[model samples]
Target: MYKVFFRICRYPHVVIGLVNITTGEKGYWWFSILHEEMLCEEYHVKNLKGVLLDELPQNGGWFDYNDINRI
Candidate 1:
């Protein structure tokens, strides 16, 4: 299983980036917050670099798990 990390954007309902914890692969494409919410509820996507959904940082580029603590 891969842990997912994300950063929020200026838009309140969008995610700007996604990072795969183990592989360090990043997805720069934007994602809908609603979709991710569904993913969390249905698929049990729990790991967001140990941060809560409402606590994700905003206005930054893609980042990996290592950057979570620094952010």
Candidate 2:
């Protein structure tokens, strides 16, 4: 079990990204503006390294994916 934290653009806080290496599953929590709370969503990826290198596109805007910290 591995957890990675990322700070996406426009959001003031960090989002928690979860990874299960054994199952090759990934997830993360984000603040849903409409719902006004945090929500979790699953991502299909091999590992954290893949997520950083391939899965998330580095767009220079509010949707930009930026790695902050991890645990």
Kindly report which residue pairs in candidate 1 clash with one another.
Answer: none
Instruction: Write one digit per residue (lDDT tens) for candidate 2, span 1-71.
Output: 44444434235543445455556566654432322121222344422233432233222212223433431
What's the lDDT for candidate 1?
A: 0.45
Per-candidate total of colliding backbone pairs: 0, 0
| Model 2 alpha-carbon drift over 4 Å, by segment | 3-12, 30-71
| Decoy 2 TM-score against native | 0.28
After superposition, candidate 1 runs with Cα above 4 Å error: 21-23, 45-71
For the record, the alpha-carbon RMSD of candidate 1 to the native fold, in angstroms, is 8.9
Per TM-score, the best of the predicted structures is 1
Error of 2 at 39 (Å): 20
Q: Deviation in angstroms for 60 in model 2?
A: 27
Model 1, 1-71: lDDT tens digits are 33345445434344445445555656643445665556567556643433323422333344344443333
